[model samples]
Target chain A: MSEMTLVEAINLALARAMEDDPDVIVLGEDVGINGGVFRATAGLQTRFGSERVLDTPLAELLISGLCVGMAAQGLKPIGEIQFMGFLYPCIDQLVNHASRIRNRSQGRLTCPMVLRTPHGAGIRAPEHHSESTEAMLAHIPGLRVVIPSSPERAYGLLLAAIRDPDPVVFLEPTRIYRAAKGEVEDNGEALPLDVAFVLREGRDVTLISWGAMLKETMAAADALAVEGITAEVVDLATLKPYDEVTVLGSVAKTGRCVIVHEATRTGGFGAEIAALIAERSLTSLLAPVARITGYDTVIPMARLEQHMMPSVGRIVTAARKACQFS
Target chain B: MASKKMADGGLPVVARFEVRHRNYLAPDGSINRPLPAFASDANLLVSLYRAMVLLRSFDRKAVALQRTGRLGTYAVSLGQEAVSVGIASAMRSEDVLLPSYRDNGALLWRGVNPEEILLFWGGDERGNHFSGPVEDFPFCVPVGSQAPHAAGVGYAFKLRKEPRVAVCLFGDGATSKGDVYEAMNFAGVHKLPVVFVATNNQWAISVPLRLQTGCETLAQKAIAAGFIGEQVDGSDVVAVRAAAEEAVAAARDGQGPRFIEALAYRLGDHTTSDDASRYRQEAEVQARWREEPIARLRAFLVGQKMWSKAEEERLAAECHERVEAAVERYLATEPRRPETMFDHLYAELPEVYAAQRRELAGEGDV
Candidate 1:
């Protein structure tokens, strides 16, 4: 067991994946010599050699399309898009090629590739550096959108994402890269994807969120506990193929739900979760689902960034409002 | 475009490059250059001609089927049969093909049965599943999108130390897309074992080659990617086959990727839904028909006393029979269940999708 940050945990997972499967390759911009901007691939190039750890040209489209080609030819390629904002150039490859390869080939060709990118805002970075637009990716069928909120989940879920048969967009929350630490065993166990993890058990109301917003949501739950309102906290790790069963069951028991995310409110994944709760567990709900999300505007630069992100106060207020009804 | 290099003892000039064009057959079915050794074999040349003939027949039948409402919209490979057959003939049985939508001739030559290709155009997903080589990708509809996939396949071969090469076929318009440029760049830098063959069919739907790019030749696009570029008279199967053979061999031998621009004209509408008469003139179309691939090959075969009018008639009858059989088989196959749409979406259906799938099944009438 090793206590590591989320970045270290991800690096460990990548190293372990490369060690286990000879077919697994790591490719991206500066993934080799620089060990990635966040050092998520630190020491991988030296440990696995340049053949396995490739530093591709600064072309996101090529990086994505190249990974698809490699995956179809029997190599498990893990491609990294430096940031979530930089993923726009490669959306064509992901949506048209990677996501459709399996269905388009009718199961003959499968893209066993992982596109990893750091998402969310917190670290006062420049424009296009700290944006969380996982909803756009999750909307693409045949793609598994996964985000890790903690070090242990990052290690486990990243390993699972790499091993998944289909293509996966693994969105690593950049805000929590070093904000938190936990003991992630190097035993190489991959946690199950397409399911939500219950971070805290409660009965009054459920706080649903994923990625960096989990920090505020969990804090809200703790704050609600002190107020004698037990709020259950759920981390929806995998956005696509969402574990609706888990969310629905929790909402059915709690009879109240508050969905939170850092993406815009209009088409945010939180709206999907809220809609599912209303559609599937409407009769069991004591109040209408509350969503605490970012405004529909560009994620502002460093100074005004905190105001754009979902705060614990907002989440707690939403949870309290949901609990107040019935 | 022209370039002049002069050394004035400045910082040593970094690079110099050139693009080559190849054509072995003339417009009048006469030889322009010495035939490559493989092209000299009568049996191999006849077999290639036979494939092109069969493709022309299949293409006509497919278009007829579409017009008769027996099949969905079809992309005709008219006037470009030699390009497809040549690229396919150059590929070894083990090498993989990443073909575009119009490369039905190449797909058929690569062992994908005519029925499977028909099924794909017939709006069936199962058509993508090939019973032949399991490694080859299905027909890519998006322009120039499959180029990167070919690069990746080549990268895999290079990584595994495999002798196989990956061949990508697209239209001239694809060279304008960034996908192809990025793929070419990747292939060039990695020196991947891949061949990018572009059939410059003169038209992408309605857009002419002149409007697509300002480059003098489509083959020169490879120069930007740092690879050898060659052009072939696409109407001459002999020339295309020779260039494809050398290119595929070079790739297999780890000489890196080679780009071949086969110049031809689209004789038919881009697809069943298009009306080429709206954009192109008949005089131009009539002139191209005289230079189409099948007739050129027939003239060569007759000149060599290897084929006669009687043999041509017999071959036409045989091609008709083969195409008819494939159509019958395609029409007889049943469509997949609607619920099966959810089947291949993922390796395993998530609970939410499974629930929606159950809902879909519940409405059996749907």
Candidate 2:
């Protein structure tokens, strides 16, 4: 077991996957000699050789399409788009080819590839650098959208994403890439996908979130504990094909749900979770479900970026409202 | 001003490049020059002629089916049969083909059944599950997107040290897409074993070739990627096959990627949904029909005494019979189960989707 940040955990997991499978390849812009902009792929090219860790030309569509073709040819490719803002070009390849290869070919071919990108705002970067549009990706069928909140989940979920038989869009929370650290055992054990992890069990309200919002959600749970309002925090590791059983069960027990996310509120993934609770666990609810998320406006630049992100105060206030209702 | 200075020795010439054009058979079905070695094989030339005939027959029937409201919107390889059939004929069975919607001729030559093609245009997923050349990609509807896929396949072969090559086919309009350029550039950088064939059919839906690109020839577009690009007489099967064979062999021998631009005309509307009369003139279509691939190949075969009038009639009848049989089989296919939509979505359906699949199947409250 080693204490590492989320980015370091990602590097460890990639090294482990490559060491285990010869078919595993890492390719992206600056992934070879530069070791990635965030150093998530540091020392990978030297260790695995330039063939396994390739630095492709600056073309996101080509990178994604390459993964589709390589995956179809039985090579497991993990492609990285530098940022979530630049991942739009890859949506064409992901939606048209990677997401539907198996169904389009009727099981004749499959795309076992992973497209990893740093997601969410709060890094105070330039325009189109900190956007979190997980909802748009989650809307794509035949794709598993995974977001790991901590170093531990990042390590485990990344391994699972690489080994999965279908294509996966693994969104690493850039806000917590270095902010969050945990003891990640390099034992090659992958956390199951399409399942949620119940971080803190409580009875008053369920604080549901994924990715970078988990940090605030956990902090809110701790703050709410001081006010005698115990909150259950559930990390929705995989957005698409999310673990409904765990979410509904948590909502059923708490009877009050507060969904938090950094993405804009309208059409956000939080809306789906809210609807899920409304449909499945409504009768058990003591209060109406609440969603604490970013506004519908564009994520502002550095000086005002913090206002655009979901803070622990907002999560705490929402949880308090959910607990105080009727 | 810059060119004038360069001419006055301000800048020395660093590089010289030229694009080659190949034409084995003239429009009049006469041999224009010495033929390639493959053209000497009478049986092979006859097979190429037969494949073009079969593709034309299949295309006609498909259009008729779409017109009769029996099939979905279909893209026909009407006049460009040589471009696809010729290139496919040169490829080994182990090679991968990333083909566009109009490359049904190539798919057919690669052993995909006519019924499977019909099933695809007929709006069924199972059609893509090709029993022949299973590794080859399905018809790519998006323009120029499959170019990168071919590069990736080539990269895989190179990484695995395999002698196989990947061939990608697209239309003239696809050359303008950034995806195609990026793929070619990447292939050039890596020297991947890839062959890009652009069928210059002179039309992209309602757009014309003049508006599609500013370059004189689409083949020259490949020169920017640091590779050899050649143009071929697309209506002449022998020319296309010879060029494709050379390109495929060069790529397989680790000589880097090669690009071929085959000049043809869209003898039909872009698809059954399109009406060329709105954008193109009838006279142009008529002139192109005289240069269509099937008739040109047939004329050459007949001139060489390798084919006869009776043999022509028999081949046409056989092609019609085969197309009709495929249409019958396609029409007889049963619709897939509604729940099967979730079947191939993944290797194993996640539990989160299981209930939804069950609900779609009308299994209540599972």
Candidate 3:
């Protein structure tokens, strides 16, 4: 096991997947010689050769649509959308063609491609660069939206996403890309997907979060523990096919839940989890579910970004509110 | 006419480009150039004419079905039958076809059964699963989007060193979209085995070709992407087939991507829901009908003495019989259940979707 950052783990995953499968190709803007803007694909082009690692022109629509075609023609293409902001231009390809090809063809054709993009705000990226739009992508069917918060999870989940039979929108949180380091075993093992990971289990209340915001959520859990509050912290790795059983079971046992995310409060994935808890585990709830999320407005600029994003203090407050509810 | 380049001192001209147009058969059923060997064969020419006629019959029946409320809104190939048949007939069975919504004629000629095309436009998903050419894509309703997909397929072929080509068929308006330009650029840079066939049928829904771009011709657009682009008289099946055969052969031989702008006219409305009369003059439509592909091919066939009036009558009756049988089959099939909408949405429906699917069927616990 080697200690690596989230970005390094992602790079390792791509390298391992490429080494194992000759059909796996890496292509995107600046992904070849430049090693990607964030360097997530650093040294891949030289290691794997230009044939497998490609640096395409700055065309997101072509990049996304090309993967759909390649996937249908029996190539496992891993396409990168530089940032979550740049992904808008190619959403048509993902929504109209890539997502519908299998169903439209009645399983005659399937797009086994993985679209990777950095998401969420925290690195103080300019406008359109730091949007946390996983909820928007998760809304689409036939596309799995995954986010990895830690180095280990990033390595395993990215491998699983690449190997998934259907198209997967793997949203890498830019905030935690290199913010932390963890021991990652690059033994070519892929972790399970479509399930939530239980970080620190508690019985009083459940702190549900995923992606970058897992940082603040885990911190809040620690603070709550100092106050003698046992909080169950659940990390939702996959947003679309959410591990509802795990979340519902936690909420049922805890009888209180606080959902936190970096996206807007309105129509964020938090709302979906809240709704599910209310609908299924409502009777077991001793208190109302509280949501700690970004505002409805756009993710603000560098200075005000902190104000717009959900903070550790806010998560703690929401958790306290949930635990103290009548 | 030839274009001359002037020298500026010691500075040299960086690049030069020229667009070529091919027209083997004129509008009055006269030969413009020496016909290709395939065009010279009476049996091959008649088969090409027959395919175009069959598609025309299918188009007419589809429009009638939509008119009588028996089918959903349909896009008719109409005057552009030659473009589709030409490209389809020229393509080998192994070459994948990425067709737009209006390329029903091409799909039909590519061995997709008349019933399958009818079922697709008739609003059924099962029709997308064609019995022939398993690698071909379904009709892309969105404009200009399929080009990159074809490029990607071609990229795969090039990567595998396979002697296969991907044929992307679109309309004039698609050339205006950035996706088309990007696909062309990718194909050019990679030298992928792909052919982009833009059936420039003069209109993109309500927009005319003149409004689509200021580039003298849509064929010139490929030059900007660093590749060869050519134009062909789409009404002339011989020209279209010859151009497509050449282009497809070149791509399969690893000569990189080729772009062909086949000029035709949209004789029918964009769809049954659209009213072309609102946007264009009836005289223009009437004038375009004179250049319709089926009649043009038949005129050439008659001029060659290869197609007699009796043969025309027999072929027309046969086409009608085939179209009517497809219509009957489409009308007899049952619509998919509402709950089935959740099935194709994913390979295996997730638990949340499964609950929703059950809820749709009134069997949900939530």
Candidate 4:
């Protein structure tokens, strides 16, 4: 076990996978000599060779498209989309092509690679850098979506995703990449890609959150404890095949739920959770299932970002509303 | 199944059906008394003819497999066999081929296993993996998008100082796509050894060649991208072979990319499901069939006395047997389970996915 941050966890997983298979490779902008803007791929190129960790042209479509060719030729590539927002330029290749290659080829070809990027709004990133659009990617078939909340889960899940037979959209919350740290048990243990983790257990209200918002959800849950109301907190590490079993169980017990995320409320993952809760456990609801999410507007270029994006205050308010404080 | 395939997903299998006759031998089983305009040894012409017949026979079998519900809606290269085979035959084994969805003949000419080709188009992702002595790219389905890949492969050849040329094959409609122009420019700027062969069978699904672009020929489109464009009689296999040879040599010698347009008719339904009558006239089809490549070749060969009736019967029997055996072997294999849809993305299955996969396995229980 080793103490690390999400950045280190990803670095470790990349090292291990590349060491294990010659076919596994890494590439993107500034990933080479500069490591990366986040330093997530630091020291990899020197440890391996330049051929394995290349710095490619600024064409995201080509990056996504060429990776399809490389992966088809049996190379396991890890592609880094500079930012979640900037990934738009390559959606045709990623969505119309990459995500459907497996099905379109009738299972003949797949883009069995990983697309990793830093997302969320805490850092005052530019317009195309702060979006947390997991739902957009989760909607695509033939793709597994994951966003680890801690160093431990990041380490395990990264390994599991790297080794998975399907392509994965792995998003890391930039706010927590270095802000949070923890001991990763057994650097070799790989967390599977599809299950959610229960962070804490309680009763009255169920709090569902993931990625960078887990910390805020925990904070809000702890605040609700002072009011003599216990809350169950669940971190949805894997977003695509969300942990409905654990969530439904918690929601059933609590009779009320608050789905929280930094991403916008409209058509966000929070909506899906709310819909699922309404569809499956409507009678168990106390107040309407609440979604504490970002406003349905583009993230500003900083300064007033907190008001634009979701925060612990917003989550706590939503949790209190579900707890009948309204 | 056709409605189901269309109602839910993917690139449509062209459904237009029309057969323009392609005769390698007169009904009398003798080549016409005229000679082919271009010639090599009797053996090479026989080689091209035999390879083309193999693909033609294969196309027939593929359609039967689809009709029997054994295979999926297939995109047949039946009438385009001459262009596909003739172009590929002109190159060396070390040369790379980037073929579009309808170039099964190119795959066969490069020695791809019939099973591999069928398995690929038949709906197996693993079908595109590298195989055999020559490197054939997995099929390019999105129209004309693979042009850059061929250019890139050619660039790799240039970078490594290797002498092999890369040939990119597409249909006439592809000349309009931006990727083609981009690839042409890149090959020209880099002086990479790549040849662009556009099989002008003249329809992008329903839109005819006249509407695809205002240009007289797709080969001319290459000139705008700074490469030489040559137009040839697509039905004339001899012309296609000679044109391919020149393009391949030009690229191999670092003369950069050359575009060759082969004017041929799509002599059959685009695939088994198409009804060409919805668009093209039956009379027009018949007129084009008279200039069919196979018929032209057979006439030329008989005039030279290079081919005989006995050889023709022997080749046809050989082709039929080979296709028959391949079909039996392919169908004899067990059908794959649908769960394979989720298989093989990551090197190993991720934990989160296992829960979902298990939940899906239990269907309706949720």
Error (Å) of candidate 1 at residue B316 is 0.4
Question: Looking at candidate 3, what TM-score does chain B attain?
Answer: 0.96
DockQ of each: 0.85, 0.89, 0.84, 0.18
Q: TM per model?
A: 0.98, 0.99, 0.97, 0.75
Better of 3 and 4 by lDDT: 3
Query: Can you write out model 1's per-residue Cα lDDT over A1-326, one digit (the tens) per residue?
Result: 97999999999999999999999999999999899999999999999999899999888888899999999987999999999889998898999999988998888999999999999888999999988898999899989999999999999999999999999999999989998799999999999999899999999998899988999999999899999999889999999878888899899999999999999899899888888877668999899999899989999999999999889999999899888876
Write the residue-wise lDDT of candidate 1 on B1-366 in tens digits.
233334454445567777777887776777777878986688898898899999989999999999999999999889999999999998988999999999998898989999999999999989999776899999998889888889889999999999999999999989999989988898999899999999999999899999999988999899999999999899999989989999999999999999999999999999999999999999999999988998888788878777889978888999999999999999999988777889878888776777677777775321
lDDT of each: 0.91, 0.94, 0.90, 0.77
DockQ of 2: 0.89
Candidate 1, superposed: residue stretches over 4 Å from native: B5-15, B363-366
Task: State the iRMSD of every prediction, in order shown.
Answer: 0.9, 0.7, 1.0, 4.8
Which run of 10 residues does model 3 chain B get worst, by summed lDDT?
B1-10
> What's the lDDT for residue A140 in model 2?
96
TM-score of chain B, per candidate?
0.95, 0.97, 0.96, 0.84
Chain A TM-scores, per candidate, are 0.99, 0.99, 0.99, 0.96
Best by TM-score: 2
Which pairs, if any, clash in model 3?
A: none
- In candidate 2, stretches whose alpha carbon ends up further than 4 angstroms from where it belongs are B1-5
Residues A45-82, model 4: lDDT tens digits: 99997767877656565556555545544467788888
Query: Distance (Å) between predicted and true CA of A263, model 3?
Result: 1.1
Compose the digit string of candidate 3's lDDT tens values, residues B121-208: 8889999998769999999988989999999999999999989999999999999899999999999999998999999998888988
